[model samples]
Target chain A: MTTTSETAQAAPPAASTVPPKAASRAVRSKNRIDPTYYWMVVPVLALFAFFITLPALVGVFFSLTNYAGYGDWKFIGLSNYVNIFKDPAILQSYIFTFIFALTTTVVVNIVALAIALGLNAKIKWRTGIRTVFFIPMVLSALVVSFVFNYLFSNTLPVLAERFGVTPLATSILANENLAWLAIVLVTVWQVAPGATIIYLAGLQSVPAEVYEAADLDGAGSFRQFLSLTLPLILGYLVINVILGFKGFLGTYEIIVGLTGGGPGMATQSVAMRIFSGFTGGDYSYQMANAVIYFLITLLISVIQLRLIQRRGVSL
Target chain B: MTASTFSKPVNKMAPLGLKNRSGRTRKSGREGYKVNWWLTALMLVASLTVLLPLYFTVAMALKSPDQIGTGTGLAWPNPMNWDNFAAAYVATNFPVAFMSTAFVTVFSVLGSLACSSLVAYAIARNWNRRFFRGSFVYLLSAMFIPFPVIILPLIKQTALLGLDNPGGVVFLHVLGGISFNTLLYIAFVRSIPVELEESARLDGATTWQVFRKIIFPLLAPMNATVGIFAFLGSWNDFLLPQMMIADPALQTLPVVQMLFQGEFNTNYSLAFASYLMAMAPTLVVYILAQRWVLSGVMRGAVK
Candidate 1:
């Protein structure tokens, strides 16, 4: 609000105040509606409304009915929602998705921060190593998952057998108990680079002078990292966690490629459930589930926004 | 400045001059300040984690069926096979899928840049208006709606509108990106000095001209950031294309790859070859623009 007033003061005088036949015909008011700006925004807004907003609303509307994604339907009025809460498969997906999201978020942050610290250190070929580390981020997730799928199903077992490692001799993707770990490993492998870059940015933003001053105080590196580095980069940590958690919540493609949410739904995510339901003649039922999922995500987003705003973070 | 200037010579000479009474040179480097050999070694080992899988992809692609079955997966194939690539290429109709993917990636990047920047410019400049502010929030709200929630409805809608094709994917990509990209762009557009636009306005430039001639050029850095995200997101996307594009012939690379996985599954060499080919363009672009891509991702994170 203050910024608005400040910018308004910063702009030129309003166009309406000036006469029509003024010598200088610059008729502009930064505070007022500019038709050209309206033109620029309206089309985008319209497209967004038509594509995103409309579909979302339509999805919600259908959630109240028993529409099977086609043909005639009747309003079921919360029946699907009630069934969703009671369904074991749906419940299982929720449990798996949350646990997966949490585990991956924690694992990724730890690995990423460590890598970022290592990259930040005065190491040889630092830039080269950093470049190598980020390679996974640029590659497609599904392709990477396929490559890993082959590794997990074939190569790993073969290697494990020859190495005399009994526990890992069988393909982990076939093991319901252990398959989620494979997903987590691949996810951490792929997503850690992105998080590392963020942590690196956070680390780099802390002036070297602070570390040097800590050195003068004879503080150990561990102590300096604990008391100085962590506190300063806390903002980046929050950003990484919020963004990473939100993203991991919607895990889809990697699951599809790696395990197909298989070993009897052991690795199924809420997204996989919703998608399968859509095609498997559970349209309205899934829409109800989706609505609930949307609410949860929306709640998280709202909380994230409030946290960011309170911290005076730009995003 | 004074502390650094005074400390420089001492810092340089300490390693040479400092010696323990026991006649062995102590570790003069600060434990945290200097490189830890163990950390470097550990990181090197970690780097192998990235390199090894990529190595396997290449190795598996070139191996004969007999060789692949006989050896440890780490072994590289002798007289590496080029036939797999040709076979995979023909099987996947590589050029069409590649072109379809390329088409989506290019337009999505372009559309995201144009629309998000325009919206940001409008909302940013008119910050005092409730409508503009509300529009910003409205777009941001779209971010929270998980794509799966709306995808089923979107499929039905697109089919009815005769948009269940690659073009529809492009439209959705652009529409989907507006939220975060506008968030990125609006922050950037606000940072741009109002004086530039004001001067342009006084020069009888219309609002459109002011934006085009001044604001847009200044937005190059953010454009790069947004463009990189848009490219990667659309290029690597699987779900939208798989569901949205009704025609098999018009599907994107990721979806097409998934569709043909069954056909290639019996042949390890062929599957790896197809995956490698599908991965080639992104790898090439990343290698060529490594610096920009890395920095762009970092910049995006700050937002």
Candidate 2:
């Protein structure tokens, strides 16, 4: 709020004078209302309201029912949710989702930040190099999953045999613990590049003067980056954290494509569980799982936004 | 000044500097720091590590079914197999899927943009001190809603409205895109001086014409940014298309690719090959638009 006020206060007055007097007056009168604006949003808002927001409302209502596609919709007050906790598969999904989100977030940031620093430094064909690194990000997550599926099932096991740990899964997503590791690893490969690009942009935007000053004080690259570069883009880092976490929560295609969420209940994330229920024509039950997942995601995001906004405020 | 004087010389004498201008510094030689030899090497390895998988995908795309399994992890095929490319397309029913995906992406992105620009223009033009805060809060609140739950209800709603038509599902894609689209465009529109629209107004142009003639052209770059995201999201999207389109004929490319992989069962070569084929649209779009992303869209994006 204060930041917005500060920005507003700092803004220069609209000073254009070349326009006709009537034009300037109308423009001045319309600066805030821009009446045409709201109408344009109607179609989009209609879509968002119908598809994104409306369905969410339906999901909430459906959670309390026993609608299984074709059956009579009997309202079963919270029974679906109560059952969600008792089911070990659902519980395993909760645990797996948390662990997957945690591992992917940490690993992705480290790799992305390192890549960002490298790209920020002098390397050949910087744009070309950034694009090359970004290739994984551009490919369909499903395609990436298939690529990794081949890598894990066909190529990876061979290497494991020669330079092996207890061959985790014959297929990466099939083994419980190894499925978790493979999902994390594959996710890191696909996601890091985009995060790295954002970080690189943040890195590039750090003023040259600060680094020059650091050098003048005899600070080495590592110290200078720590003291100067990191602090300036702390907001961006936080943004990436939120993005990476949010991204992990919705990680469906990869999990489905890679492990199909299991040899049993190994890699089935919250989304996967919800999907499983829906595919079985158990809409009401799936809606409950989805609602719980949504609320949890909303809660985490709220906390994240508050934390980041607070840090951004202070910085 | 003194540091740059030092900065240039420190880079020249590293063992790998080709000219090896060892005498303090050569006139035009770039500065050398303690032979960043390790970073260069690490970067080389990192570059390969990232590229290797993609190279492998392309390799598998060309390899035959027998070769895909028997093939060494990284080995080049001796009798390079390219027939897999033709075979993947046929097996996947890719041409039909491709058209469906294109149609869906185009309509959805356009829908999202029209919706986004309207809302943004309205707010940017008419913001009152009191109302501005309320609208921003509402819009920002919309951003807080995570996306997974949107899928389940979408399944219900699509059934309710007979949105099972491939065309009908585009709205679902557009709906999901609106939150970001509005937020981004509103920020961009705020930066545009309103006087241009006012001038058009004074010339007796309607608000629609003003937007069409003036603001829309100016907003083109930002639109491209939003379009890129919308296009890619729509093109590569799996779930909504998976759920909404029941008929195999109506299925989008990504969904078809998924079905193709499973239906093939043990024939992993064709699956990976078709998968690569599916990715080509986004890959091409990203490569073409990648430059505009950082240089054009991002210029306005960063506040």
TM-score of each: 0.90, 0.86
A1-315 in candidate 1: lDDT tens per residue? 234334444555654754442313333344435577789988899989999999899999999999987789999899999999999999999999999999999999999999988877656666577778888988889999999998998888888999999899999999999999999999999999889978876775676568777888999989999999998888899899998999999999899889999899999999999997657998989989999999999899889889988887642
What is the per-residue lDDT of model 2 for residues A52-150, given as tens digits with 9 covering 90 to 100?
Answer: 667778788988999986668889999999998898878988888998998899899999999878765645555666667777766778778878887
Could you tell me the lDDT of residue B186 within candidate 1?
87
> What's the lDDT for candidate 2?
0.71
Per-model clash counts, in order, read 0, 17
Cα error, residue A271 of model 1, in Å, equals 0.4
Error of 1 at B256 (Å): 1.7
Per-residue lDDT of B274 in model 2? 82
> Best by TM-score, which number?
1
